[model samples]
Target chain A: MGRTEIIEKVNTVFRDVFDDDRLLIGEQTTAADVDGWDSLKHISLIEAVEEAFDMRFTMLEINGMKNVGEMITIIEQRVV
Target chain B: MNYTELEKNCTRSTEGFVDSCTLAVLGTGATQHLAKAVKGYAYSEGIALDVYDADYNQIDAQVLDPNSELCHKSPEFTLFWLCTEKLYEEFCQSKQRSDFADTVIQRVERYWNLVNGKFRTNILQCNFLQLDDRVFGNYGNKTADSFIFQLRKLNCLLMEKCLAHRNVFLIDFCYLQEKYGIDALRDSRMYYVAKLPICTRMLPEAAKQVVDVIKAVRGKIKKCVILDLDNTLWGGVIGDDGIENIQIGELGIGHAFTEFQMWLKELGKRGILLAVCSKNEEAAAREPFEKHPEMVLRMEDFAMFVANWEDKASNINYIQRTLNIGMDSMVFLDDNPFERSLVKSMIPEITVPDLPQDPSQYLEYIKGLNLFETASYSEADRERTRQYQEEAGRAAQQCQFSDYGEYLKSLEMTAKTEAFDSFHFSRIAQLTQRSNQFNLRTVRYTEQEIAQLAGDERHLTRYFTLSDKFGDYGLISVAVLDKQEDKTLFISEWLMSCRVLKRGMEEFIMDELIRTARDNGFDTVVGEYLPTAKNKMVADLYSRMGMQPAGGGRFTVQVKDYAMHQTYIRRQ
Candidate 1:
């Protein structure tokens, strides 16, 4: 998948896990940009994203990622 | 349902539910996800569950304290999710390790006593999932000091402990581990990051296990399984294959069908009524059960059998009416997808499981559904199929007489009514939970509560058993009269099995109730009817039995003014 495609799929995961239909995310978006993106929901978000992309995240990557751009980069590396 | 759907259901509104229950969840680890999953699953089951999730790792503090939040909520059920990972950690730290199972059971007993002493809530304890540390390789099975050995022993000890406590029940988490495997149910990374013990993918199933026990305890259970013939019970079409060539024995691909029949026969022995609904001739259907030496299910095993060319939906409806059980309480299994879909679409309440295309996977698939979870069982359950067969006999004999009263009298019916004793506690409690249609007031009690009522001087409890020339309906009805102020006896509960309906059992019970009231020096007998979606059959029962209405569904009749009901049942 391309960067834009990964971002679009990740956006859908965010929308679903946050229970928001109108949620939109960009490469520069961080946890603070999304409502209800606390530590508990972050786990659910990681699980949903892994399922959506058919990939598992490393423990360090899951904890250290700060922005949606980094997540998209990780997905871009894994998918290729 | 998947984990995402269950999490989404957590936010769904439960405002319109007429049936609701309160549950308090406490765990040695984090239980936020499990509690959410339980609430979501209960919503899917159409039960409004108000779940109180305790703070993480607070099972001891919350249970030991008398004035804690758990006590304030006073939930109907208190679930203790004791995780094996936490238990392993305790084992690593403990100096004395050989008796780990016994020590852990002692702690569990303390928690049970503390909670039971404070409230009347039912305790649900999750058993340990047998996770092997592999320190001793395969020698763990023989070594008592091994973690795997202790875990297995702990599960068995928990079952024995629960047997002694009437209010305690096990969740069978170890069985789930065996089904899904450890890798699917556990995530070490998630456990380290979050205190959650069960993986997110497995939460819905774990929640379902909890909800199944709760549903069974609340009297929602499946009583009968309606089966389809052709490839469902055997290998080929009996009508076309001519029975002798049809495969059901030790031949190739026939072992699966034989094993399937064996499982169904065991279910029949467990008191689940089995009926045949096939689309073949009656002789073709009855031939294999009668003459085949390899067949596990005989003619006597089935309570009812119907074989014809009629549509399966109509046939299942007829079976439901004849069995007198709710459509929701019946599971119809057919190997044909067309029939399964048709039955599902026609009767929305009935449970129709889609059989796999392969016959070999039939028993394995049904075993995972856990469709027959029950809360209580007694020796009376073994006689259930015979009772239903006798009911069929009575039904067939009813057409012989034009007068219903004369038919009842000619049956030579006799009833034995006695006060609640230790021998009938399990069956009495089971009746109180299972009887819904003919139940007035619909008050459910557990065995512990029934024993308490039997011992209390303010209450008089009676359980009635009915029999005829055909067979016996063991512990068919129950009535509890509470002594009130002003020399009045209040009928707190009156419920009877639908199998014995229209057999003069109601009149017989009422006669006994009035007689007991008069003999106890109570001048008035009061009865009440609390209406539910299912109990409408007994709405006017009190009035029909000569009790005058006193408003608010309460009926009263003076002991002196009460006339003896003429029933065919002679008291034993």
Candidate 2:
């Protein structure tokens, strides 16, 4: 999957986890940008992203990601 | 079964919580995900719950303090989730490994007592899973005072303590560890980051165990197993492969089928009814049970065996009719995907698990389904299959007599009825929770509630067990009469097993109620028939039993004018 495809797929997961269908996630999108992306839902969002990408994310990798673009980059690396 | 799918399921909200119960989760680490997983599973089981997830590592404070949210919520169920990591930490700090077991047991007992003394809810606590330590390696089992050995011992002690206490239940962390490896169940990195003991990927599975307990207690248990014979109960077709050729014994691939039959047989002994719905010749189907030397399930084991060329769905319908149980209470297992799909599309209520391609996976697959869940078990459960089989015989006998009343009389049925006592309280409570079809005022009560009602003098509670030449239907009917003001007694609960429905038990119960009302110096007997989605069959039960409608689902009978309804069943 390319960067744009990964971004589109990742946005779907974000929209689902936040329960916001109109959610548009971009390179600069962070937890603060989503509606219900608190500490608890953040775990669920990361878990959902991992499942959607069919890969496991380490705690360091999950905590280190500052925005959606970095997470997508990591997902692309793992998918390859 | 991943967290993502579970989270999606959780998104489907069920509002305004009718049939609601409260649950409090007290864990050492992050437990909000557990609550979410539980809510998702609970909604699927038709339960709207109010779940309280205590703050991380506040199990002690929440359980001990009277001012805590748990005390205010007063949940009906309390779940204590302490992971093995916490126990291992405690073990590492202990001076003696042998003494660690006692310390752990004492600590658990303190929590159990504190919760039990403070609240009335049932506590579900986890048993510690021994950590995979290679320091002692495989030699840990041989060491009497090793940490692994003591942890194993501690688990046993915890189980014994739970069994001794009426309100405590054990969650088998070891079972989960075995199913999914310990590493999969735990994530050290996540634990350090978020204080979550169980990994998100594995939360749904663990949460399901707790949800199943809640379902069992709430009377959503599956009662019957509708099985397919060819390639399901055995390896191959009975028509093509003779009884000798069909693989079903204790050798090779046949062992899988044998083990599957054994599992089904054990379920039969545990009060789950078994029926055969097969598409095959009757003689060919009967051959395996009759001629095979190693057959575990005999012809007598099945309540109803439908062997014909009809479609699988129609056969299942026939089986449901013969057993007189709701379709939701039945599980149909077939090896062929087409047959399974046919049953699924036709009877959407029946649970049809997706069977694996290989026969060996059948047992494990069904075990994972957790179709048959029950909160309480008694001696009555063991005889459930036999009683159903006998009821089938009675049904067959009724065809011989032209008149239904005469047929009932010919059976020479006698009922042993008694007030709610120690011996039958558990079964009575089980029936009240599980019986949905014939239930009037379908009110579910826990064993604790049943015990209180049984002991109260103001309430007259009775359970009736019917027996005939065919066999015994153990504790088939329950009645709870509440005495109101002005010499009137109200029927708060009136439910009977569907198996004994058309056999004049209703009239017998009405007669018994009238007699009890007169004996208690009451002039009027009132009855109620509440409407629930599953209990439409008994909507007009009050009027059918000769009670005059008194408006608002209420009916009345003047005890002075009430004559004993003639019935075939005589009191023993």
Give the number of the best model, judged by TM-score: 1
lDDT of each: 0.91, 0.84
Model 1 CAPRI quality:
medium
TM-score of chain A of each: 0.97, 0.94
Name the 10 consecutive residues with the lowest summed lDDT in model 1 chain B: B187-196
lDDT of 2 by residue, B47-125 (tens): 7777888888897788789988988888889988876677877777877877777888988889888887777887888
Q: After superposing candidate 2 on the true structure, give the runs of residues whose Cα lies further than 4 Å from its correct spot.
A: A1-12, A51-58, A69-80, B15-20, B109-120, B132-136, B142-145
Q: Candidate 1: lDDT of B322? A: 93
Please give the range of 10 consecutive residues that has the lowest summed lDDT in model 2 chain B.
B1-10
- Model 2 chain B, TM? 0.94
**Residue B400 local lDDT, model 2:** 97
lDDT of 1 by residue, B172-224 (tens): 88888999899989887788888778878798999999999999999999999
Top-lDDT structure, candidate number: 1
